[model samples]
Target: MSTYHIPVMLKECLEGLDIKPNGIYVDVTFGGGGHTRAILEKLDGGMLYAFDQDADAKANAEEFQQHRSFTFVESNFRFLKRQLRFHGVKQVDGILADLGVSSHQLDEGSRGFSTRFDGELDMRMDQGAAVTAKHVVNEYEQKDLIHILSAYGEVKNAKTLAAAIIRARGMKTIHRNEQLREIALTCAPRGREMKYLAQLFQAIRIEVNDEMGALHEFLEQTPEVLAPGGRLVVMSYHSLEDRPVKNFINAGNIRGKQEKDFYGNIIRPLESITRKPIIAGEEELERNNRARSAKLRVAERVQSK
Candidate 1:
């Protein structure tokens, strides 16, 4: 587990939860069980429920099987409310979500999540997913590719890159990361090849995994699954994810638009605890490069009048 993936902002995330020794908590992205282990340590007889879609993560959860207080659900956090219901859990004290791909997935060449790895064009976080990165690269229309690269990746030259992909695939299918990278290099600006490729891959992976959609679903259910005053701690790695999370915490919805009651009181479901997202400290940055992009936000469920 030590090498699976280093937990980003470990101390900060644990602090954000403001853990209760005997309260029920959930770790939605139980990547390598690093944070799960820490949460378990804090609990005496409390419960720590973990969720992970990847089979590899499920196997890692087995390491904590000896602790009866720990429960692992082999499913996506998008199904948060329902899965918890299966375990007779109606509400929780806190929920911690570490968004984006885990370091283990990136380091494993076969997963095709890293720019350094020249592997198959398969970026599904759950291997069972049907739509692989190869499908998006080879089958998506030019306009669709442009939209994905522009919106999901924030790639500046999305138009040119999308056109290049379409043209290159006409000669042969883009079935490998190296093959796609070669085509992307043709459009990448000087000295920025890696950055462009990273964005490109991010865009494709998000689309294949329906990350934005899943995040929206998960956020919508938090109000129902968390008890009043329960904490919602999320760590996101990109602006695309951070924006929605920030919006939800601020406006009580992803659109960032406020709703009011007949009495003119704002009908917010959660209260923001961190005005600004937390970042990794210098000491942690030195130990793990993955922490460099992490941004953590904490909020607590609002009590109903």
Candidate 2:
């Protein structure tokens, strides 16, 4: 279970937090504990709570071996509100969520998270969870498949791909990565194999985890969980994740627009720290390919009751 998770945009996230030595903070996506370690170093009297839905992330959780103020909770972050309340805490000074699967999950052959890997069709981030890519491919209807592929995967040929899947799935249940790849290839244009297949896989993974839906819910609770002047630093790998976060912080809604009162007074709980999303640099892109798509957005909670 020795997995490699290279935290993307580490420095930017740390700066975004504006870490207070004695302020309570949370790392919602504790993949490999890379960022968690950085967060710990910046804290003294403050405590850091890290959450990861995947049990496998615990394998790298050992980095904080001697940490007294770090707590790792294994669960989906969509329920972040309830979970933190259960801990007898209400507000936190800072919260960071890296809303993407880790490199370890993608590199591991058995995880089926990568299109490069030929394994089972299962892509459940939390192995203990019931839903997987298999269910999405095997049970999803043509209309549903089209929606997932187009919206989540951003597949250009979503309708064609969905049709191909439906046709192939009828003959037999697709249980392995190789079979799924073949289906994708057969449906895709001859030269578009790589691009088409990757998009299809991305679509299925998002659907299996309800990544977009969960991200929306998580952002909805952020304003409530954050204390006044608390920082909300979020790192998103895809537009779907970043868009909502960017909108919510700037306008206090998911639409990324400001709200105005009858008297034209602007009211919002959070203020967008970055007018545009922060992208990884050339150095980081070269070091970690994952950084190519990473976008870091930060916001500070405004004074509100």
Candidate 3:
């Protein structure tokens, strides 16, 4: 992999939190420790807890000193609140989650998070996770397949693609990218193979990891865990992930309904740190095209009256 992690909007994220020397912080995605390392530099006696589900991430822990203030948790960040509680900490100053697959996962063909590579269709963020791209292709029913393709991938011919997978599974297994691609080709829009295939793979990867589900849980707990005036810096790479973030931030709840008070005024739990989600600057885009889709939403906790 050329870059282990190309931290998107590093400067912007750092500024979003306005990190304090004594404040506690958490980096939910510790891919290559880029954000964790950056957070570490800004802390004096502050505690930094880094979490990554991939066991390989533990190997990268050697890059930083085993400091008193820094600790690593080899688990999913979806349990951000529970894990923090284990450390006997509450109400952190800030929390950062760079959601979805890491650059290293995509860059390495074996992990198969990207359509660019022809590796096995195994896209489990945590290797221990039971489901994989193979399971989605071979096991899911037509309707469920369509749901995943449309919900996570936004694939145009979702029903057709789901039908194809269903028919193909009747004959034999579709395990690797090559086999899945061959089956998907029949349903994919002709001359639009790459994008369509990418969508399908993305959909499978999201299901395999439960990325959106986990994000929802974390966001639900955000208001409770963050200190008053605490910051949440989240970077989402696509609409599937960004949409919920958009909805949850704009309104108090993910359902997008206004929370009415006695006066019928909408009571919101969060105030947008940025009126609009921040995007990568041109220079950053030149270095990493992945930054093109990255949408950052920062919010501060609002105390309930």
lDDT top scorer: 1
lDDT of each: 0.92, 0.86, 0.84
TM-score of 3: 0.95
Per-residue lDDT of candidate 2, residues 36-148 (tens digit): 88899989988888888786787677667579888877778888888888887799999999887877787677888877888888899888878898899999999999999
| Per-model TM against the reference | 0.98, 0.95, 0.95
True-structure lDDT of candidate 3 = 0.84
> Which digits, one per residue and each the tens of the lDDT, describe model 3 over residues 35-136?
888889899999888888886687787666577778898888789889989989878988899985777887677887767777887988889988888887
**Stretches > 4 Å off in candidate 2:** 1-3, 63-65, 189-191
What stretches of model 1 exceed 4 Å from their correct place?
none
CA RMSD per model (angstroms): 1.0, 1.7, 1.6
Best by TM-score: 1
* Residue pairs with backbone atoms closer than 3 Å in model 3 (clashes): none
